[model samples]
Target chain A: MQPVIEVKDLCKTYQDGLKALDCITLDVHRGEILALLGPNGAGKTTLISIICGIVSPTSGSVTVDGRDIITDYRFTRQMIGLVPQELTLGTFDLVRNTVCFSRGLFGKRSNPAYVDDLLRDLSLLNKKDQEVRTLSGGMKRRVLIAKALAHEPRVLFLDEPTAGVDVELRKDMWDIVRRLRESGVTIILTTHYIEEAEEIADRVGVINRGRLLLVEEKHMLMRKLGKKRLTVQLKEPIARIPESLSSYDLDLAADGSEIILTYDIRSSRTRITALLQDIKNAGMTLKDLNTSQSSLEEIFVSLVKEEA
Target chain B: MNLEAVKVIYRFEMLRTWNTLMQSVASPVISTSLYFIVFGAAIGSRIQEIDGVSYGAFIVPGLIMLSLLTQSISNASFGIFFPRFTGTIYEVLSAPVSPFEIVLGYVGAAATKSLIIGLIILATAGLFVPLRVEHPLWMMVFLLLTCISFSLFGFIIGIWATNFEKLQLIPLLIITPLVFLGGSFYSISMLPPAWQTVTLFNPVVYLISGFRWSFYGISDVGVGVSVMMIVLFLSACLALVWWMFRTGYRLKQ
Candidate 1:
């Protein structure tokens, strides 16, 4: 099956000689949630802006649902819905008209029912008649989502959808995104919170300094790069790691109340048994032990740092 | 270009404009009425006809043009500027609506507003000045031309402004002073010959002069010159606005 969205050799250099994007190319499969993770100024918003047709590409092209964004802008734009990072709305506009008119702007025939259903889904039914300026921040963000979904586009781009939102509202928004995916809408979202991507995205793409770093499946990435840490509560406090055991690169913590051993999960020769034997030989016993695999947040930080 | 899109956007834009109808239409009508009350009744009582027309009658055209110019510019400028300042413009640009649709929705609404307010001011001027129209159809043609011209100008200003403060720069500094100094409150013939020569440089004087000609069949400046100046200004503003949309100047990013 063809990817729902294809970006090839995309590049953008602003008039003032700022390189916001390099030769970035990637395929976003249909009906999957893909998270674009990058540091600030990592070209996340720039990429979305270009695809949305607000910013012209300095080079390359994008195809949405097999339609060229530039040559077939009307058709291509009809399939894309973008929630900009800016929480901007017509303040004096009513909830109903905002969404309905947005649908009409796409040349779609009036579908009051679709708009009504969308408003209900976004929890905006109550505020449909109210002025937008009077709505809460969370409500405003939801309205943005509603406006994007008004035309029932197949692809939705959420540019940092959860930024500057309260925790409860963030969860609510996450649920709405989940429902949208269940309806077969391909979602491309950018996020500063690694855990958001980890929780919802089927795949992850990391970008830094206008360069594509890596793209991989969420679970596979974790399994391939994740390191395990064994926090062993020592039976007795040891002042320091023994001279012979220093080869393991262990950390003796807080008067030896615990010891930390970090090693790759993929390594078959983790000296766990040997370390236990050595601990016994050194006249120490474990009080307790627990293992933890690396998190996506850690991997993201390390990847960004490595790129830098 | 799509009529459906235009109607949708126009209705949305019209709704926004009506929210401030008092500023755009009603307030101008009321203030222009006072101008008739004070200028036509009190001032005209002493001053005779300037050109075979009562002092009250002479100021009617200028007063109508005054409301038309100010309201048209404010309507179009604020219509575009508010969207930019509030960042709703991004949503519009991101939508499938063509730039033409955005332009029409805004400029059309402002032109409609200008027409309404211009007519209202004319009607109110009648309650005091006992105004008479020799060519009612010509009045409409001239009024619409002025509306389109100034609306285009304000549309360009809106696209050029970066902030709320920037939006005020042109209307307050440039448009208002031009209208006031353009013989909107008086005839250029009353000024000294040197002052008339200086006022010739003010483009707005020509608009008022031409519009007044459409009403009374006489004007201090030649009607041909006023019509030519108006056509030139309108064409220039239209070109700039189209260029703004084509290049996606400040609107796109």
Candidate 2:
């Protein structure tokens, strides 16, 4: 499938000689959720801003569905919707009017029914007539999403959509994103939360210090970097691992109450059966055993550490 | 040009004005009426007439022009500046709307607001004194041209200003003083010969002179020079606005 957005060798340098984005390139597939994971000031917003035409790239180019963002700005911009990180709203405007006005900004004819459905889906129907300034933070965020979707854009960029949101609102946002994807709208969101990307992103791109470290399928990335650890509790405290268990890479707890064995999940032979047999043969009575797999957060920390 | 986009922005701005009716409309009208009361009643009592026109009538055009120029700048500047201040300008910048459409919507709305206030002040002045438009057509022409030109100037200031202080700086320190010194209360012809020559260099003089001429068929400068001066200012403002959008000055980064 043709990518909905293509960015090539894009770079941005501010007037103060600060390099915000450096030789970055990315592609967002149609109807897929691509999460850009980065620390603060890692050029996530800058990248999205360039594609949405809010900021001019210092060099390189971006195209949406085969049209250059600069040369064909009107057409390219028409295809995009951006929910900025800032909680910017027309304070005195009614929720309904704010959403309708956003639709008109895109030159779209008024579609009150669509807006009504959108508001209902976002659970903002009750507050439709309320002035924006009166709504709670979460409700205002819903308004931003409604406004962004009012134009029915083909591609949407949510810059830190769930930042500072409560857990319930965050989950609601995830559900909303899922629904938008179901409707065939391509989504590119920037987030620093590893769980956020792990939960919803089909593809995760890691960025650090103005450079994209990697972009890969979330599960594939997990499988490649994931590690499994098995911890065994001995019936009695042991001072060290038995001589027979020397072949295995094992760590004994400082108190000698448990043993931890770490191994790559991707290896063809886990050798678990042999390890269990060897453990039984050594006359070590295992009271209990628990296994845990590395999470995306661990993988991300190590990845950023390696680059640093 | 995308008329729908322009309409959206224009309507949004005009709605903001409606929401602040007292600040946008009533205050200016009331203030201009006070000017009619003070300068017309108090001052007009002593100086009965100037250059064959009643003192009260002569200052009518200047007062309207004064309020029109200041209000036009303030309305347009605040209109655009507030969006930037609130960071909502990103919405407009990111949309499919072009720079021309953005300017047309904003400047157009600002001019409309100022024009309404100008007409209201005119009507209010009529209640105070017997006002006459010697050339009704020319009066409207001057009113519209002034509205558009000053609004455009305000748009530039809106983009140029980075904070509230800068926003009010030009309108208060520069334009207001220029309007006052430009003879909003007294004709430049009434000044000494040397002072009159210097006053002629004030750009606001031409705006007031041409507008006053439309009311009384008399002016401090030739009507042609007045028209030429306003057109020149209008072109300069247009050029500056064009450059601002092109370079993304203060609007894009």
Candidate 3:
């Protein structure tokens, strides 16, 4: 399928010689939630800013729905909605007025019914007439989302949407994002929260030091790079691994009461049966056994560490 | 041309004025009325008229010009600067609106506010002293041109200002001083030839002189020179604003 947004060989270098993005290329498909996972200052905001036309790229190009962002900026921009990291709302404007203003600024004719529906979706209908300053932080965030969607944009960019939000609100925001996707709006979000990507993102892209390390399907990435560890608790304490079980590369617990073995889940041969038979022949009975897979957080940390 | 975008921005800015009616309209009127009482009534009672017009009536155009210049600058500057200051400018920059559309909305609203205040001050001057505008059409022309040109200048200042201090700097330290020295209270002819020549260099002189001529049918300088000066200043401000938007100076990085 043709991507909704295409960033080709994009590079942005500031005047002070700081390279914010370096030869980065990405494609966002229609109606998919693509989470850009990165640490602070990893250029996630810069990438979004470039695509949204808020910041100019020093070299390379970006297009939205086959229109170049620079040459056909009007069409491209009209199709996009950006929720910046900051609250960025006028303090005195009414919630409903602010959203309507956004729609109007995009050259959309005023539609009170549509705006009211958008407010209701964000749970801001009650605060529609209230000044923005009167709303709580979460409500303010919802206001931002409502404003972004007021123009009925096809693609939405949320930069650190859940930053500083409480867990309950974060969950609510996730539900909102999912609903937006269901409405056929492509969503691209940048976040450092690993679980945020793990929970909602269909595909995840890991970025570090202005470079895109990799982009893969969330579960596929997990299953590919994920390692499973098998923990075996012996009935009796063992001082060390037996000579026969040494080939299995077993690690003894600190108290010598448990044996642990880590293997790649992708590998065809885990050698679990052989290890179990060897343990039985060695006269060691197993009290209990359990296994756990690596989480996205651990994989993210390791990837970032490798780049560093 | 995105006229809708322009209208949206214009309406948004005008709504801000409506929300702050006291500061936008009432404050300027009250202060200009005070000026009429102090300079036109109390002080002019002792001083004779410089031209055929009354000292009280003669100062009307000058006072309006003074408020117009300053208010136009402040309104436009703050209109654009607040967005940048509060980070709300991203909506504008990311919108499908062009630079020209953005300027039209902001400068248009700012000029309208200044024009309203100018007319109010004019009516107030009539109550204080008999007022006569010999060429009412010319008076409106000068008033409108001054508002738009100065509002454009103010828009440039808004984009150039980095902090609140800088935002107020030009209006306070530069434009305000120029309006005073530009014959807002006294005609330039009252000064010696050398001082008069120096005063002509102050751009506010042309604005006030042109506007005052429309009232009394007399001017220290030729009416043509004053009109030409205004057009030249307007064009220069337009060029500078165009360049600023094109280069994204202090706006986009």
Candidate 4:
């Protein structure tokens, strides 16, 4: 499928000569959720701002659904909905008016019914007449989402949508995002929460400093880089891992209560059966055994660390 | 041109004015009325006429112009500045609307508010002094041109201002003094020749003189020069605003 948004060789240099983005290129597919995972000051927001046309890039070009963002700004902007990281809303305006006005800003005709449905979906229908400033922080974030979707954009960019939000609101936002994706809207969200990316992202891109380190299917990435740890609980405390088990990448607990064996999942033979035999031969009695796979968080950290 | 976008922004801004009706409309009207009472009723009683026009009537145009200029700048500057302060300007900047349309909506609404206040003051002035519009057409022309030009100037100040203090800076230190020195009360011709020449350099003089000429058919400067001066200032303001949007000065990161 043709990408809904294409960013090519994008670079940004601030007035003080701090390079915010360096030759970064990316493509966002239609109707897919792509989570950009980055640390603070990792240029995620800068990239989003450039694509949304809030900040101009130093060099390189971006095209949304085949339209240049700069040359065809009006049409290109109409195709995008950006829920900024900041909670920026007109405090005095009614919830309904704010959303409808956003639609009008995109040159869309007034659609009261559509706006009503949007507010209802976000659980803001009851407060439609209330002033935005009266709403809670979470509700204000929902209003931001409602306004962004007011124009029925084809691509939605959520910049740290769950930041500072309570768990309940985060769950609600996840549900809303799922619904938007079901409606065929392409989503690109920036987040520092690895769990969030692991939970919802179809594809995850890890960026650090000013460069995108890697982008891969979430499951594929996990399977390729994921390591499984075989943890064994000894019947009694041991002073250390016996020399016989030293061939395996083994770690001994400081208290000598357990042993951890690490191995890649993709290896043709995990040699778990052999390792088990070796442990038995070493005269160690395992009271319990369990295995845990590495999470996306670890993969992200290692990727950033490798670059650093 | 995205007329719908312009209308949305314009309506939003006008609605804000209505929400602050006491500040936006009532305050200016009441304040200008005080000027009518002090300068018109009390002061006029002492000085019967100036250049054959009643003292009360003579100051009417100047008073209206003063309020119009100050109110126009305040309204437009505050209109844009509030959005910047609250970071809500991102919504407008990210929208499909063009810069020209954004300016039209904001400046248009600001000018409309000032015009409403100007008209209210004019009506209130009628209660104190018998007013005449010898060139009714010219009076309207001056009123509208003044509102638009000053509103545009306010827009520039809005973009240039980085803080609240800066927002009120130009309107207070620069504009208020200019209007006062522009013969909002007395004619420049009454001043010494050198002082009159210096007063001629003040742009506000042209605005007030031309507006007063429309009312009583008398002016410190020729009506043609006043019109030309206003047009020239309007063009300069428009050019500056155009450059601001093109360069994304303060509007874009």
What's the TM-score of every candidate structure? 0.94, 0.97, 0.97, 0.98
What CA root-mean-square deviation does each model show from the true structure? 2.3, 1.7, 1.5, 1.4
Return the candidate ranking by TM-score, descending.
4, 3, 2, 1
Q: For residue A209, what is the lDDT in candidate 4? A: 86
**Clash pairs of candidate 1?**
none
The segments of candidate 1 whose C-alpha lies over 4 angstroms from its true place after superposition are: A231-239, A253-258, A266-290
lDDT tens digits by residue: candidate 1, A112-202: 8898889999989989999889999899999999989988999999999999998888899889999999999999999989989998999
Off by over 4 Å in 4: A254-257, A266-273
- In order, the TM-score of chain B in each prediction is 0.94, 0.99, 0.98, 0.99
> What local lDDT does model 1 show for residue A31?
97
Better of 1 and 2 by lDDT: 2
Please provide, for model 2 over A1-308, each residue's C-alpha lDDT reduced to its tens digit, 9 standing for 90 to 100. 87888899999999888899999988888899999999999999999999998999999999999999999998998899999998999799999999999999998988899999999999999899999999999999999999999999999999999999999999999999999999999999999999999999999999988899999999999988889899888888888899999999899984987889898898998878788899889888988999898888988999999999
Query: Between which residue pairs do clashes occur in model 3?
Result: none
DockQ, prediction 1: 0.63
TM-score of chain B of 2: 0.99
| Fnat by candidate, in order | 0.77, 0.83, 0.86, 0.83
Q: How far off is residue B207 in model 2, in Å?
A: 0.4
**Best DockQ goes to which candidate?**
3
Instruction: Kindly list the per-residue Cα lDDT of model 1 for residues B118-205, writing each as its tens digit.
Output: 8888878877867778778877878988998888888888889878787788888987899899997788988999999999999989
Classified by CAPRI criteria, candidate 3 counts as high
In order, what are the TM-scores of chain A for the candidates? 0.97, 0.93, 0.94, 0.95
